[model samples]
Target: MLVLSRRAGESVVIGEDVTITVLEVRGDVIRIGIDAPRSVAVHRAELLEQLETVNREAASPSEDAVQSLSAALRSRPGNHAG
Candidate 1:
């Protein structure tokens, strides 16, 4: 990671559009402001991770769901073996 030190009121620019500005520094906590275009997506790291986990769980079929689907397919009208 590229690390740089900036005091409050100092800003860092990324690409040609995004700007990250330090707003306040209180003890160990620091507050920052980001300026970007509407098309750019900015998300907190932890929140993004949570969203990814939820999406993965939703996309994957459970064992019970797979079994139920298999059973339904086996019992369908034209699916029987002669």
Candidate 2:
């Protein structure tokens, strides 16, 4: 990881399009602004992790859950089979 010291209003450029600028700094919290084209996708790390977890859960369900859902569907009022 490349670490550089930058004060407020200073910017760090990535490649040719992305730019990260420091907007404000308090005692500990620092606010930053990111400038990139609409084509670029930017997301917070934690939110991305949460979305991945949800996707994994949806992709792979437990056997018990599959059985329960099947049973529920079979027991529905209009689901009788001849």
Best by TM-score: 2
Please list the C-alpha lDDT of all candidates, in the order they appear.
0.96, 0.96
What's the lDDT of the predicted structure labeled candidate 1? 0.96
Q: TM-score for every candidate vs. truth? A: 0.72, 0.80
- The sequence of per-residue lDDT tens digits that candidate 1 reaches over residues 3-82 is 99999999999999999999999999999999999999999999999999999998998999999998888889988664
Stretches off by above 4 angstroms in model 1 are 65-82
Pairs clashing in candidate 2?
none
With a 3 Å backbone cut-off (N, CA, C), the pairs that clash in candidate 1 are none
- List all candidate RMSDs to the true structure: 2.9, 2.5
Worst 10 residues of 2 by lDDT: 73-82
Q: For candidate 2, lDDT tens digit of each residue in 22-72?
A: 999998999999999999999999999999999999999999999999988
Q: Model 2 segments beyond 4 Å from truth?
A: 73-82
Worst 10 residues of 1 by lDDT: 73-82
lDDT for residue 59 in candidate 1, whole number 0-100: 93
